[model samples]
Target: MLQPRDELPSVLYSAAQVRDLDARLIAAGTAGFELMQRAAQAAWRALRRRWPQSTRVDVLAGSGNNAGDGYLLAALAQKAGWTVRVLAVGDPQRLAGDARLAFEAAQAAGVAVLPWAARTSLQGVLVDALLGTGLSGEVHSPYREAIEAINASRLPVLALDVPSGLCADSGRVLGCAVRAELTVTFIGLKLGLFSGDGPTLVGDLVFDDLRADPAILAGVPVKARRLTAAGLQALPPRQRDAHKGDFGRLLVIGGDSGTGGAALLAAQSALRCGAGLVSAATREVHVGAFLARCPELMVRGLASANQVLPLVEAADVLVVGPGLGQSAWGRSLLSVAASRSDKRQVWDADALNLLAAGVVQAPAGLVLTPHPGEAARLLGCSGAQVQADRPQAALSLAQKFAACVVLKGAGSLIATPEGELALCDHGHPAMAGAGLGDVLAGIIGALLAQGMSAQAAAHLAVWLHARAGERLGSQGRGIAASDLIAPVRELLEEHSPCLD
Candidate 1:
């Protein structure tokens, strides 16, 4: 098992795969009961650290290994002279393997084991070992009732592995889930805990490898990696003598009538993020206003795709679909942009809608940024279905479109065509406002223009954009999309600078 203080491994695994790894360890001569004991010890340590003054603990357990961990924890608390009670929701006799052994140990330790009832007064720190990663379908009757009671208690909850009723694979709530104050996860980091509803349900997250052999971890395939500042800061330094033209030009192609702000946001972000030159292709009436707002941008007024084609031909990167409508004019401009095979593309907003309509094909070396609704359109599925399994949906988008895909939502996912995945866990709810996606597209476009590979650029852009939102989110509501431009520039300088 990896140590608590060790740097987190880059690899992420699914629940089933992690279970298989546990089985492999057991088969390799380590007993399953010993692993269970280690998990209990880790949870006990985390619980005590989180709530040192609380001497009373209520352990809610089920029949699985998750329940076993709770049973062991209760026993430990009892031995320490703290009042501990074990509420078993499932028949203890039905527990198999390590779980059965844990129950026996709890009984031998003289901890009070009682049949769980909804009316049970759950006091002190509640240990939720009710469900593990093996849960699939909606949480059933008794467990749901128990979970509801636990939530109603408002006591601090310490989850054994994952919060009961949370799908460890997708982060979707199984009917309903227990909101934990702290969650001690064992073996591998489940991708679900960082995405969708996972972040909210899981409080302060803790991971313990339980001293699993390093060689064993190397054999299992990873599902995704969590984006961290250290990894994103690994961007290559710029050459001292490099000229502006070497960075690359970024052309913003959007801003239909009445939505010029979205287009301006993208152009402004690209300019702030170190694009060599920034230009906006928008409604003729908005050109003067956009130019006045940002004199550094090369604002152009175009009425047709024919007029924009020459501009598209001259640019090194294209950021399309900000405020782009599905009208004929928008379709015409998108077709022109899509026809260009040489330039790298960052497609967002209605450009994604246009692609979903079979309006154009996403060429190689392209990035697609889509929120849940847009992702649903791209996948021919409902938004609920997309959120149900965000990671899978993101990977599917990358594979089907053959482009770097950014599935934007609460826990944004960046997926590469090669099946590598990275999660951005830093954004705030204030980012739910309009034009954020457009800004993100421009940020990625700027990185690509600066010669960062599509994968690297997408990863860096997502992290920076999320961190920027987090930095600005505390400033209160109605945060304008343009507000991100300055902070994004600062972050870009901090990560990758033109002068450095």
Candidate 2:
């Protein structure tokens, strides 16, 4: 079993950065082969602990350092009196350096080494040490065939480092990725393991630093960060003399004609998540229902676009486009919201559509929450493009608009204008319903109203919202958007309590 700290590291690194850190450690006095040996021992220990009853193992060894880890692991198993079989998928004749040494050690230990075949028999626990992060293209030829065979084997498997064939930076599959029951990664945690296809493929991931010097890591540049409670800038505890006016007022804009519920949900979420005052600007038809549903909210009927200016002037933060239809009414109101450059704002739904169409422009320092479909429209590319390289797409959106971007989906990514990226890996598939984005927008608005920076508010809000979804998601589907607000509030309090 893994501990809490093993879930993810606070800082994330690219494959190149991790490799550089490895080199740094080697230069710092630890031999490169010594590090490789430590990695093998760590993986061997974890494998044995995870499956203590099994005494027979099969290791799929390729030609890189990753294969070296597998060879050393086979040697360890052989030393432990366990039956060990090494399937040399990569030509062992081409192995060099520490890898060649490991292969020779495995051979000397009496571990049977066989050339990989299409029909290689996998026995006991299977160790996947095939393609490493250096792989840049699709899985081809014998490696692809070997990966397919590994997947075909209905046995428990442990992947060394990242799953073979997974992009170490993007978390995307390269042709095919190995599916493992448990994965033990050495040194730094790759960003790919937390996003895209990573969570499903690398189950129960654990990290071993290979005992690299802490001083060496401090000098390395991190590519991104995984948002966690400890890394956030918390909302301060309220004063004993706190009043409603202490927190900033937020306005929820949208709900054209028949879509009043979206605006109401946004407004309610803002109120629940700690906005001092919440106001809703929606169709005249929904005002009475809004008052009855959330009496604390100051709901106004916006019959004309002109009415939005008054609400805009009163709000400290504006959350736009929750059930906003693309009718003239919505466009008129969005125009008013977009024209102003003074207020902190969050744009979603129809507002995003308008921005994509070039019908409206965002004021400076705004937040954009777009799902893949909306993101494609914004980026002028296919949805597949955004999903294929989510990190790049999110950074592109942030840089293009000079605003904070929350590219929402599996492994939601938060990118800021300064080029910093944060990943939220807490959400569940059951939260994949309508209106969740509306709730998320409102929550973000509430945090901004409370005076969090665009980056801080976005990173924290995404984490809180995803956590709420995860908590309720296990109830098994049909998770309503409203179900998340209360838990989100509770979570926020725990993260940064109101009374300290």
How many residue pairs clash in all the candidates, one count each? 2, 0
**lDDT at 219, model 1:** 85
In the range 311-346, model 2's lDDT, one tens digit per residue, is 999889999999999988999999999987899999
lDDT of 1 by residue, 1-500 (tens): 22332266656789987998898888888899999999999999988888989999999999999999999998899999999999989889899988998999999999999999988888889999998897989999789999999999989999888999999988999899999988999999898888888999998888989999978877888889988777774446668786789779989999999989899999989988888888889989899989899999998888998999889988999999998888998999999988887899999999999999999887876899999999999999999999999999999999998899999988899998899999987888888888888889999999999888888899999988988998999887777788888888888778765454
> How high is the lDDT of residue 204 in model 1?
81
TM-score of 1: 0.96
Give the poorly placed runs of model 1, Cα more than 4 Å off.
1-7, 233-235, 497-500
